[model samples]
Target: MANILEIKNLTKIYKEAQNEICVLKDVSFSVEQGKFIVFIGPSGSGKTTLLNLIAMLDKTTSGSIIFKDKDLTKIDENLAAKTRLLDMGFVFQFDALLPEFTVLENILMPAIIANKKAKTYAKYLLEKFGISHLANKFPPSLSGGEKQRAALARALINKPTILLADEPTGNLDTQRKEQIFKDFAQTAKEEGTTILMVTHDIHAANYADKCYKIEGGKVE
Candidate 1:
């Protein structure tokens, strides 16, 4: 597999008053195509910040992030938005489903934003995740597990090569958490999606092809 993303000497520093809070320092790594990579660490260890930089959701204090041979750190915000919408899929800790929309509608949002029809793919994802029956149901009507499944389906609708997940199973039970990671692993295998996920759950490590432990602003 080719290198999908490469980070060299990444660093993030926040100066609060006279004290400088360094979130990340001289971090470096590479992500390959179709790999399930995980970053595990304690709170405030810069895992999320590193993910955000890789996702192009934030600027690095100092470093170079090369995605597909292009330097993301130098891209303008407009390009960043387009890159986020077309190249990356995100599954946040809260699921972030719209309350007023049904499962299928929520999943179709990215396509709609891109002015494309996604009904066929949306239906396929729902079926793939065993949530086709809930297509018309709103987020509030779904269980924690069901909502997360729907969120996963939504993330895949755009067929993003990269999926960035942050604590995706934070609100689910043990069984549900295990099931979600299993689904994620299967998705990566069959769909050729490169997943980079950050979680505090040590159990999540079992499903990853490679794991990195971040501590004290560094990756090991």
Candidate 2:
């Protein structure tokens, strides 16, 4: 498989009270197309920060992030935003679903924003993730697992080339977490979507094709 994402000598720092706190230092990695890669670490280990940088939600202090052959570090805000919409899908620890929208509506939100055709794909994902029955229901009415599944469906609405997940199973029970991981693995295998996930659970990381542990701002 070809490289879908690459990070080289990445570093991030936050200044507070005349002191610099380093979040990431000289970190590097590459993700291949159609592969599942997980970053495992303890709390405050910069996993989320790394994901944010890769998703273009946050800027890096220094270094390069290449996605689909483009150096994201050199892109302007407008181009970065466009790239994110065109090539990236993100699922957070929180479902981030709109309370006012039904499950189906939430799933289609990305497509609506991009003015893309997605009804058929949305319905298929909803059914595939076993959330079809809750299509008309609101987010508040669903369980954590159901909400995450809906969020996953929404993420895929754009059919992005890369999916970035931050602790996707953090809020689910063990059984539900296992089921979701299985679904995610199957989806990656069948659709050839590149996935980079941040997880703390060893069992969850086991589902990934490759795993890296982050500590003290470096991959171990």
Model 1 C-alpha lDDT per residue in residues 64-142, reported as the tens digit of each score? 9998888999999999999889889999999999999999999999989988889999998999888999999999999
lDDT of 2 by residue, 1-220 (tens): 7898889999999789999989999998898999888889999999999999987878899999999899888889998888788788999999999999999999999899898989999999999999999999999999999999999999888989999999999989999999888878887898888988888888977688999999898976
**Cα lDDT of all candidates, in order?**
0.91, 0.90
TM-score of each: 0.97, 0.97
**Candidate with best lDDT:** 1
Q: Candidate 2 regions off by >4 Å?
A: none
Model 1: per-residue Cα lDDT at residue 1: 80
Cα lDDT over the full model 1: 0.91
Clash number for each model? 0, 0
